[model samples]
Target: MALEQLSEVIQRCQALPENSYTSEDYDLFTVAGRTCIEEGNSLQLLSIVLDEKNQEIVQCMGWNLLPPLVQVLLKKENKDLPHCLAVFNHLIEVCRPKELLIGLLEQLEHDDPDTTAESLHVLLTPLQKLLNLGVRKASSLGMALSSVLEQLCKLPVPETTEQEQDDVFSLGQCCSELSAFIQPFVEEAQHNHIRGKDSAQMMGDLPHNEDELRTELLKCMQVLSRLLLGVQLRDMDTLPESPLRDFASSILIGDSLPALVHRPLLRHRHIPGFLEEEVRYPKESLACIAHLLFVHHLLADMFPTVYQELYEKTLVRVEDCGLPVDLLEIKSFLSVPQNLVKVMTICPHQNLRSKGLKVFQLSIDKFNTEAKYKFFLMLKTSNHSGVEGYIIKNIKNQIDSALKAEGGNVWFEGLHLLPLLRSVLMLPDGPETDLLQYMDIMESLNLLRYLVIRDKTGIWTELYKIEDTFLKPLRVGINMSRAHYERELLITKEDKKTKAKVSVGDEKLPNMTTDTHIKALHSALHTFDMIESVLVRIEELVD
Candidate 1:
C-alpha cells in the first residue's frame, strides 16, 4: 500500500511539466521518503528497483527516487534482514541515496572493522557527501570508531602479493576521497557562530534547511576523521607497500603542513579542471581538518611526531608569511595546540605536557582578539558542563601553574583570562569537583584577593574611588544576605511557637524555643559581617 502510494506520487510528479515539477517534485520526493518508512512494504519495492537483475527497474527509479527510498529502508524498524541487506547492496551500487549511504558508512565504522572497511569502500563513490555526513555526525560516531580503527591498525604491512597492495591502495583512495569531502564541513562547524542558536538554525533560514545540511556535513566529517586516523595508523606499518605512503610521508615530513595550515588561499593544483570552474568553497573544511588533526594527535599514537613536525613547519610559515597572514587560517592552526592541551590533560602522558605547553605558548603568542575570546569562552563552557574530569583537572593545573609561574601575567597582558576563571568558579556540581577543588578553594580566593588589592592601589584605583562603584555592589549583596536571614529567622520562630501550642493532651511539649533557628540566624549574620568587612577594607584603601 505504501509502495503504491509512493508510486502514485512519483507518477503524479513525473506527469507535471519539467518546469512546473521543480517545487512539486521536491514535495513529492520528501513525502515518498517519509511514507516509504511509515509503510513497511516500501523496502520490497526499493529492493526490486535496486536489484542488479532488474537494471531497467533500477534505472527507471532515478536518482530522486533512490535517496528517499534509501532513507525509508534505513529508518525502518523490525525490517527483514535479507531484504534490507539486499536494498543496501543495491543502494551502494547505484549511489542513489547519497545521504543514507553516508549515514550507513558512519554506522559501519562502529560495526566489525573488516566489515566496516569493506562497507566503507563500497560506499566510496559519493565520497564528498559521505565526508560531510561524517563530520556532522562526529560526536555521536566517535564512540564506535575506535574498534574499526583498531582493526585497520592491525592489517599486515608489506603485503606478500600485488592484490594485497591493491586492497590497501583502495582503502587509501577511500580515505583521500573521504578526507576531501569532510574538510569543508569541519571548518564550518568550528566557525559556527556562538551567538546563534546553532549552525543548523542559521542554515535553515536560508533556502534549504541549514540544520540538516550542517548535520549531514558534521556526520561526514566524523567518518572522515575516524577513517583518516585509521588509515594513517595502518599505513604507518605498510610504508613500503602502501599507495598512500607518499601522502602519509608528506604529512610526516611536514611538507603538507604549510599547505594545510594555509589551505584557505591554496587551490587544489593537483586536481584536473579545478582551476577552470568557479567552485564556491565551503567554510568548514579547514576547521574540520584541524579538528581531525587535533583528534588524531590526541587519540592516535602517531600524531605527536606528526604534530611536532607540523607545528615547526607552521611556525616557519608564519614567520615567512609575516604578521599579516590570513587570520582565519592562523586561528585554525593555533587552535590545534590548545585542543591538544585540553585533550592531553584528561588522557595524560608524561611526554604530552611539554608538547601541550609548547602549543599553549604558541597559542598565547598568535591568538588575536577574536581567537583569545573564543578560547576563553570554550574553557568557560567546557568547565561548566559536558566536560570530563581529567580534562578539567589538567586544564586547572595548567592554568594554575601558568599563573603561579607568572603565566597569568602573560595571559592577562595579551588576552583576558578572567572569563575563563569565571567559568572555573561557576563549574557545575559533579565529579569534575576534583578539578574545581584544586582552583576554587585556594586559587579563586587568591584571585579575588588580588583583584581587591589591585582595585585599591593599581591603575584601577580611580574606578574603585567613584561613588556606588566597585565596593558598593559587594555592600548591597551583604545587606541582602542579612535581610534574607532575618526573614528566615522570623519564620522559624513563628513555626516553633505554633508547634509548641499544638501539643497533644498526653504528650508533653518538647522545648520548642527557637534556639536552633537563632543559631542559624547568627551564622548567617556572621557571613554577612565577613562580607561587609571585606568591602570595608576595600573602602578604606580607596580613602
Candidate 2:
C-alpha cells in the first residue's frame, strides 16, 4: 500500500510538467517528506528516490525544485542519507577537472588563439573546482593543491613596473592562502561524534574513509555551481587550457594577454554544512524493569501491551530528561506505587520510544534471594544484558523496591527506589555535563520529599548533603550556560563616522544566535530554580 501511494506521488511529480506542479505542491512535498512515514504515504516517495531512481518515471524529471525537498530531508542524519548519495552521484557526473584542462589546451592551438585573456577565464573553471575540492578533502589533498598552485606561479616575472608584477603574484598568493585554510575543518572532523538524543544522528565523517570522502565531495558542488551560475559548460570547454599551461613554463611567449593572465582570481566562500546532525540529550543512563503482582496482573489485562511492559521493557534512568521549564510539568501519565507514595512513576502514555533507549540490566547476582528464584523466569521474560553498571543499577533497584515493600503490604510499583535516587545524585559526572533528564531529578527530589515527611529528623542531614553534592553542580552548570549564551547574544552597535554594520547572522558561525542560546540558557536556569525551590521547601518541612 505504501509503495503504491509513493509510486503515485512520483508519477504525479514526474508525469506533470515542471510548471504543472504548483507552489502548493511544493509545500505538500515538504510535508510528505516529514509526515509520510507517520500519516500518509509511509515513506513511499523516499524509496522511489533511493531504490528506483533509474526508472523512467523520475528519469525525465528536471530537478529544479530539488533544493527545498533537500532542505526538509536533511533535518536528521538518517533521513538525509539517500540525498547525500544522490548529491554525490551528481557531483561525480559533473566535475571533470581533467576535461577542463584539456579544453584549455584546445584554445592554445586555435587558429587565432588570443591565449592570455580567454584562457585565464577558462582556467577559473578548474581552479574553482580544485579549490572547492581542496576545502572538502584538505588533509590529504592539501599538498597536491599547494603543488598545483606552485606550478601556476612559475610564469615569468615581467621585469616591468612593480604594479604589474604585484598583479601576477596576488593570484598565486590567494590560491596559497586558500590551500592552507582547510586546517580547521580537518581538526573538527576528527573530534568525537555527537551521539545526540534525536533520531537524526549525523552521518560518520571519517577523513580516512574513502566512502565518506566520496559523499562529502558534494559540499564542493554547491559552491562550484554558484560560481558558474549561468555559464554553459559547453561554451567554457570551447576555450583553451593552454595559454595558462604555456605561461607556466617560465616563458613569456607572444600573442597572449599578459594583462588577463595577471587578473585576480574570484574569491569563493567555504561550503556551509547544511546537513549536520541534530544533537541528542542525556548521554548516560540505566534501565530497570518493574515487577507485577496479582492486582497489577489484572490491570495489565485491561491494556495488555501497556501494562505488560508498564515498567518492564522501556525503563530509562538518567540525570535529567524533561523539556523546557516554562512548559510547567512533564507531559506524562500518573501511575501509583505501593503505599509509601501515591504517584510512583510517570510513564509515557504515547510514543514510549521517546522515553529514550530500552535496555536490559537484569542479572542473577543483583536479584537477591527473593528475586533469585525468578532468575530463569526473568531470563525467559525479559531481554537481558550483562553490562556491569546497568546490572549493578538493576540489582540496586530490586533491593530498593523490596525494602520499600517490607514497610507496607501494598503491591510495589518500584516508586520508592532509594538506591536509584542516591546512585543518580552521587554518581560521578563530567564537569560540564548538562544533559540530565528532568524526571530523574524529579524522582530523586520526590523520594527526598517523602523521606523528610516520614522521618524528618533523620532525613534532613542526608537531604542537605544530596543538595550540596548533586544540585550544587547542576546550579554551576546552569550559570555557566547562561554566561556562555550572554556572550553569544548579538549586540547591534551604531557608528557616527561611517555607520559600521554588525549582522546578527555571522556567516562564519552556525547555531550561534542571541535568541536560541538565551532561551536555552533561560530554560536551564528555570529548571535549576525549580529544583532549588523544591529542595528549599523540603528542607523547611523537615526543620
Candidate 3:
C-alpha cells in the first residue's frame, strides 16, 4: 500500500469507536500494531484505545487477544526498539495477560542489562494482580521466568567498595522488580518439583545457565521473604501457600534450602583504607535465613502431619549433632502434638508423653501462660477441635502447675475457653463415661457458665432450658467466676477418669433399659426435632 493510503487507513482505524476491536476486528488492531512498530510510531495509542481509557475496547477485543499481543512483541527482535518496547510496557501495565506477561519476562534473559532491567520493572508492576488472578496453569511462563533469572545469575557481581559495604545491605533496588516478578513462579516451581511432579521442569532447564539462574532465583526468594515478612502481621492463614513454603521448610529442617539460599554470587567484597568497620554479610544472610525458617514453620502448621515429620527430622539432627536438647525443644513441642496424640492413643509411650510434657512446659516458659492458653484455644477452634480438647485436658494438670509458678493467671487470661469446653461436652458417651466426668470436673472448675452466658442467645436458649429457680443461680455463678477465677482448675487423677460404670444389677447392658437410657432416647428425639426446625428456618432465611 502507498504511504498516504496506509496513513489514511491508520487514521480511519483510530477514528473508529472502541467497539471496533472485536474478535472479528482483532486483525485490524494487529495490523495497526505491526504497522506502528514498522513506522516507529507508538503502538501505545492503539493499546490505549484498545486497553486503557476504553472499557468498550477491552470488551470488544476479548481477553484472549491480549496474550497474542505480548507473544508478538516478545517474538519480534529489534534493536533501538522504542515503539515496540514502549507498547510492550504499556500493554503489561494496562491489559495484562498474566501467563503471557510471565512468558515475556523470560525474554529478559536474552536481552542486555538495560533492556532486561526495564523489562523487569514492567513485569513487576502488575505482579500482585497476576497472582491475585490465580494463573497457576504452569504455562510456558514458568520456564521463561526461570531463563530470565538465570541471566541475572550470570551478571558479574561488582566488588563492594568499602563505602558501599558500609551502607545498608539491600538486594539492589534495581533488581527488586525482577525479583518480585519471579518469586511466586519460583515458589510454584519449587513446590511442583518437591511434590515429585514434572510441572517444575521449566525451572530445571536453566541449570545450563546455572550462575544466572541461581542468582536470579536467590534474588526472587529474598524479595518473597521480604514481602511475606511485611505481611506476616496479618493472619498467617490468609496467605496462600506456594512452593516457597517448602523452600523455607527445607532450610529450617537443615535440608537443601540452605545451599540454594546461600548460593555463591559474582559480587565481591572490598575493604576501604583506614576504615574500622567490618561488613556483616553473614549476619544479614543469617537473619534472612531465620525469617525464611519462620515462614516455613507457619506453613507447616497448616498441615499437622507434615509439621510432625519435619519436626521429628529436626530432632534427629539435633540428637546427632549433640546439640542442647532444650535449644530445639520449642520446635519439637510445636511439632509433637500430632505425634503425641497418636502415641497416647495407639502405643501409650511413656517417653513420648514425658518429652511432650517437657516441651509443653518449655513453651509455657518461653511464652506467657496467656499465650499458651490462646494457642491451645485456637487449636480447639480448628477443624480438629475434638482431638485438641482430648489432648489438652489430658495434660491440663501439668499445664496448671506450669502456670501456677507465675501466680495463676491462666483463668484470668480469658482466652475463649468455651470452644474447648463445648467440644468436651459434645463427646459421644460410651465406654467413655470416665472422660465425660473428667469434662464435668474441668467445666465446674473453669466455670462453664461463662461459655453458656456468652453464647448467642438464640443458640443458648435452643440448647438448654433454665428453670425459673435455676436462672438466678446460674447468672450469679457466671458473674462470680468471671470476677474471681484467677486460675483454671488443675485436673487430678480423679478428674482424669471417673469410677462410674454400669453395674449388672443396676442396668443389665443386654436387657434392662433404665431411666438414664430412656432419657438418652428422649434427647435423641428432641435433637432430631431441633435439626428439622433449624433446616426449615434456613430455608426460610434463604427465601
Candidate 4:
C-alpha cells in the first residue's frame, strides 16, 4: 500500500538464494487481491515500483508486479490500456536492459571490444502470464497482447560476426518464450478471417471487414515471422550441431513456421486496406510463402521434418504464392526420398515445374548419381496414384527440353529423370481404369521415343534394363490403341445404322464434325511408329 511495504517485498525477493524463487503465482489476479480498480492505488503503486532507482528493487518487483497489473489492465476498460503498455515497456526494458543494448551498439561501433549478448532469461517467466491468459479467447487480453508484441518488434536486435560467414543475432535468443503465445493467434485469426466470400471477392476485388481487430493480429504474425528469420539467420550454418544454434531453432522451427507459411494463402486478400499501405514484411512475393523460402533453406538440413512439411504446403500454395520454393538451388530441401515423392506428385504449375526441371537438369552434374536412385525409388513406390502419370508426362517434357537445351555438360549424356521413366514403365500389372493405364503406357512410349532419338547411345548403354522398361510399354501402348480404336469404330458404325433405321428428318448432327476413331487410330499409329524408330536407333547404337 505504501513505499515501505513495497520495500519490504523487495528485500524479501532480494534475499532469496539463486533458484530459490518459484515462477509467478498465476492466481494473483487482482489489484492487491481485489477486482475493482476503483478501490486501490494500483496505478500509483506500479508507477512507484517502476520508478525505484535501485536495480534490486526493480528486479524484485518484476516477477510480482506486471503479472497482476496485467490482470487489471486487460479488464477491457480503455483507461487501463496505457497502464498495461507501461507495465509491458517496463518488463521489456528490464529484460532487454538498456545497458546491455548500449553495450551491443558500442561493440558494433568499435568492432573491437568483444561483448557477449544478453540472454532474454529475465523476460521469459513473467511474460508467460500472457500465455496463461489466452489472448485470442479474451478480446481485451488479445488487444493488450497485441500492444506488447508491437513494442517487442520495435526493439533492435543486434548482430555480432565471429567470422566472414558466421553472424549471430540477439533477439532470436528470446523467441522460444514468445512463440507459443504468438502461434495461437495465427490459427484463431485465420479461422475467423476465412469465412464468407462475396461476389466482389470472387471477382478479385478486396474483401470488406469492419473489425479492425485483425490489423494488430496480422502485425503480430509479421513480427513473429521476422523474429523467426532473425533466429534462422543467427545460426543457419553453425557447425552442424552446436547448442546455441539448436536452441535458436527449437523456437523458430516449431508448428508456427508451418502454419505461418500458409499466411499468404489464408489471409492475403483479407489484409485490411490500412495495412496494405505500410506492411512491414510486405509480400515481396506473396508474404509468408516467400518468407518460408528463406526459413526452409535455413532449417531444412537440420530438420528434415520441417523440410517435408514446408515442401508439401508449398506444393498446395504454388499457384497462389507464386512458386517460391526452388528445390534445385537449395539441394538440402530436396535431398530426401520422401521429398522427391512430393515433387513427383505436384499436379499443377506446369510452367513452374518445366522451369524447375531445366534448372535441375543443369545442376545434375552438381548432384551425385545417387539422386537418380532416389527418384527411381520414389516412382517405384509412388504414393500419389492420381498424379503419377502426369508426373511421368512432365518428365518427358523435361527430357525433351534437356535434349533441346544445347550444352556440353557431361550429365546431359545421361538424362537425370531416366530413373523415374524406368519406374513408370515398370508399373505392376493391375486393373486401373483403361484410360488411366493407357495414358501411362502412352507417356512411357513417348518418353522412350525422345530418349532413343536424342541419346540412342545412352539408351543402348542401359539396354538390358531398357528391354523390360521400354519394349514392354511400346507393345502395350500399340495393342491398347488398336483395340480402343477398333471398338470406337464399331460403336460409331452401329450408331449410324441406328440413326438410319430411325429415319428422322433433316437434323444432320447439328453441323458438328466428329473426332473419329480414325483420328485416334492415326495418333496411336504415329506413337507406335516413333517407338519402332527408337528401337531401330537403339539397335544401331548397340551395334
Candidate 5:
C-alpha cells in the first residue's frame, strides 16, 4: 500500500501492450490500487497515471481506480479531493462513457442522501463530457437520454415520501442535470441549417448531426410530455401547497425558461411549416410547451412581456405560413376546454384575454351538445364573473339553437336542456351575494327571461324544480341585497350631505368626492331592481 507499490503497478502497466495484460498483472494492479488513498500521495499518483504515456496503465486499471477515487471524494477533509476529481475526468476519456455514466447513476441511489447528492452533482461534468464526445468516440445517445428521462419521470416528488429532504435535493439536482443535458442539443438545433426532417429515432445508431441531436431531444421531450400531460396545472392557483405545487409555482413566477422552451419559437425569424407538422418532433415539443403555458401557467407573466414576445413571434410565423395553429385559439392546449378556460381566466394580458374569449366563442359551437353541456358545467365552476356570464350566454344560445327548425335539438332539448339550464340559472354564493362582483347573475337572469319567453313548453314540467331550486333562492337573495344596498345608499347620501355642509371651502379634496361611491351604490341598486323585474316577468309568465 506504499507509494512504491503504485509506482511498481505503473511501471508494470507501461511495459504491457493494450489488451495483452495477464491475470497476474491485474492482480498486482488491484493489490497496488489501495496506495491511491493510503500513501497520502494520491494526487501525485493520479497525475502520473493520467499521463498520455500511461494509456496502458489507464486501460488496464482505470475502472479499477474509480472505487478508491470515490472513497477519497467522500472524505470531506481529504486534501487530495480535487486531484481525485481530475483523475475521474481523465477516467471518462479512457473508460467507456456509458460505463462511467452507469457507475455515476448507480451511486445516485445510495441510501445516504449525501452520497446520492454528490453522485448526482458529479454527474454534471461527466454528462457534459459524454455529450461533447459527439459521434467521435460513441454512437447516438438518444436512447440513453430517453432512459434517463424515464427514470427522472419516476422520481417521487419531494415531501410526498419519507425521504422528504432527500427527495427535494435529488429532484433539484435532477432538474439541474436535466437542464444541462438538453441545453446544448436544444441550442444546436436552433439553427435552420442543422434542422433536418423530423423523425423520432428512438432506437439504433444515427449519424451525429441534426438528425441525432433532434432524436435525442425528441425522446427526452416524449418522456416529459408523458409526465407533464398527465398533470393538471389548470387549477394550480387553487392547489394545496405541496413540494410539486411549490415547484410549479416557482417556475411560473420565475423568468422565462431556457432554450428548451421559448427558443424553438423565438429563434427563427420565420419558421418552416414543418414546425407545426402532425409528426412528432416539434409537435411533441409544442404540445409540452403549450401544456406548460396553458395548464400550468408556466410562462405566464404579469407584464405579458414573455407572452407578448412569443405571441408576436408565433403570430408572424402563423401569418406567414398560414399555419393552422393560432395563438388566439391557444391551439396547443385548446383541445381541452378547461385548459383554455384556465388560461383565459388567469391570463393577465387584456389583449390575450379578449382574444381568448373570441376563440372560446368561435370554438364552443364546434363541440357536440354533450361536450358543450359539460363545458358549460366546467365554466360555472370557474368562479369568474366573465367566464360565468359567457357560459350563461352560451346556454341561452344553445337553447335558441335547439328551438330552430333545422337545429337537431340533440342534447340541448327537453330533459337534456334542463341540466344545461340549471348550471347557469343559480346565483353564485346565493342572491345575497355581492351582485356587482357577480355580474354573471344578470346573464343568468337574461337566460331565464329568454327561456320563459321562448321555450316554456319544453321546460314546463321542470318549472317547479327550476323555481324552487333556482328562482326562489334568487328572489330572496335579490330582495335582501336590494334592501341592504338601499340602506347603504341612504346612509351614503346623508353622509355626503353632511360633509357638504361641513365643508366651508370652495374647492373639494380628492377624498371628499362621493360621486363615484354614490354612482356605485346606484349601480348596485339598479342591478338589483333589474334582477327583481326579471323575476317578476318570469312569475307573471308562469302564472
Candidate 6:
C-alpha cells in the first residue's frame, strides 16, 4: 500500500510542470516517501527517483525528500544502504546546497546518541561534498560553514577509556573531516592572498572580491583555531596529531609569514593594525595560535618574536592611550594566559598590569579541573616568581579540594601532584633567596604550611626534603627580608623628619608625605610579617 501510494505521488509529481507542485502535493509526497521508508521499501521508493525518466520527480522531491532518505542512511543495518546513498548523492547534485545542509544539520542534531552518531557516520561524506560544491559555486556558504563547524567543535570529547571505546563517531574523525574541509580555503588563501594569484585563476568557486575572500578565510581560521583550542582543553596529548594543528601551523608559522624574523619598530598607532595582520591573520586568530604554541612549548624560537611584537604594541597602548575600557573583554587579549602574565609581570603601566592580573585570576577560575592541571603544568616554569606564586595558590586550592573530596580528584592526586608540589616548593637560591622579590616563595610557604597541617602522612614523609629545600631556605629568607624592611622603615622615617625640618622655611617645597617608596617599604614589611607568622605556624605543626 505504501509503495503504491508513493508511486501515485511520484507519477502525479512528474506529470505536473516544474514549479507547479502545490503544498498539498508536497505534503502527500512527503507522507508517501516517509511511509515507504518506514515500510522497508525505500529501495523501491528511491529506484523510481533514481530512474532517468523521473529526473523531474527528483527535482520536485527536492529537499523535502531528504528527511526520509536520511532516516534510511542513519539506520544501522538497512539493506537499502546503497540505494539510499545513490538517492542522497543525487539530491546533493540537484537540490540547493543550503537547504540540504540545513536539513542534514537538523538530523545530526537528533537528541539520541545512536541517531546522532549514525548521522555523523553517514552524513560526514555528503557534508564534505556539499562544502566542495558551495566553495566551487561561489555561493554564500561561509555562514553555513561557520555554523556547522562551530557545532562540530562543541561535540563532546571522549575523555575516559570506556567513553572512548564506546564512541561511535569520535572527535578525531570529526576533526579529520573538518581539517580536510578547511584545506581548500587554505590553498585558496595562499594562492590569492600570499601568492598573488587572481581569484579567477584559483581552483573552485570563491568570492571574486579579495576582501570578501579574506573575510571568509579569517572566519575559517578563527573557527579552526577555536577547534584547536578545544582539542587542547580536552586532551593536550592528542593535539600533536590533530589535523587542525597542522593547518594552523601552516598558516601562522609557515615561511610566508616571518615567524622567525623580528618585526621592525612602527609608530604606536599602527601597532594594532600591524599585529592584527602580522602574517595575514587577524589578532584573535594570532592569539589562538600563540596560545597553542605556548602550551605545546613549540615556540622557543619563533614565538618569542611574536611576543616581542605584542609587548611593544601593548606598551604603546598602555602608555600613550591607557588601558582600553574593554581590554579585559577582548577575547584576543584574554585568550592566552602567558600574555596576561606578561601584562601583569612586565608591562610598565601599573593600571594596565592591575587589570591584567584581575583578568588573569578570573580566567584561571574559569578553567575546569583537568584544564587547570594542564595549565598549571605549562605555566609552573614561567620563571616569573609572582606568576609561579599565583599558580601555586591555585594548586593549593586543588590539593585542598582533593583532600576534602570523598572520592578523590584525579588531577590533584598521585605521582603527578607530587612532582607539581615539589616544583612549586623549591627555592632555587635557597637560604639567600630574596623573599620580597619572589611572591612564589611566599605562596609556596603558605602551601607547605597547609600540607604539613593537613596531610600528615602523604606529604609528611617528604618533610625532610621539604625542610631542607623549602622550609629552611624560606626561614632564612623571611628573616632577611624582615630585618631589611625594618631597617629601611627606620631610615625612611629619619629621612622624612630631616626633610621636614629643612623644608620648614621653604613652604613651597612639598613636605615628606608617605610617598611611593615609603608605601612600598611598608607593604614589604607587612608581607614579611605575614610570611613570618605563617612560617611559625608551620614549624609548630611540623615539630
Number of the top TM-score candidate: 6
lDDT of each: 0.45, 0.36, 0.40, 0.45, 0.61, 0.64
Off by over 4 Å in 4: 1-332, 335-365, 372-427, 430-477, 500-506, 509-526, 532-543
lDDT, residue 29, candidate 1: 52
Residue 91, candidate 6: Cα error in Å is: 2.1
Model 3, TM vs. native: 0.27
Query: 340-371 in candidate 5: lDDT tens per residue?
Result: 67668887655556767765665665555666
Tell me how far candidate 4 lies from the true structure as C-alpha RMSD in angstroms.
22.5
Q: How many residue pairs clash in all the candidates, one count each? A: 31, 15, 5, 0, 1, 1
Q: Give the best candidate by lDDT.
A: 6
What tens-digit string does per-residue lDDT give for candidate 3 at 1-543? 323443444455456775454443465545654554455444444445444345444333323334434434545555425555555444444554654444445444444554544444444544434544544433333344445455544333222232123212222333444545555655655554454434336457422222222232333343333333332221235334323334344323322444434643434323222111211124344555554444345434433333332334445444321433344347655555545544443444455456555553333334433445544554453333334544455335433453455535443223343343344334233222232222332333232333343332122432342222222333343344433322222222222233234346786354233444445545544433443343344334323
To one decimal, what is the Cα RMSD in angstroms of model 6 from the true structure? 22.4
- Candidate 6 has its poorest 10 consecutive residues by lDDT at 264-273
Cα shift from native, residue 155, model 6 (Å): 1.8
Which of 2 and 3 is the better model by lDDT?
Answer: 3
Give Cα distance to truth, residue 23, candidate 2, Å. 58
| Clashing pairs for predicted structure model 5, backbone only | 431-477
* Candidates, ranked, TM-score: 6, 5, 1, 4, 3, 2
Q: Residues 332-431, candidate 2: write the lDDT tens digits.
A: 3111111101111222222222221232221133223433323322222222222223333443344445456674412112333333345445424533
lDDT computed for candidate 4: 0.45
Candidate 5: lDDT over CA atoms?
0.61
What TM-score does candidate 1 reach?
Answer: 0.33
Candidate 4 residue-wise lDDT at 449:
58
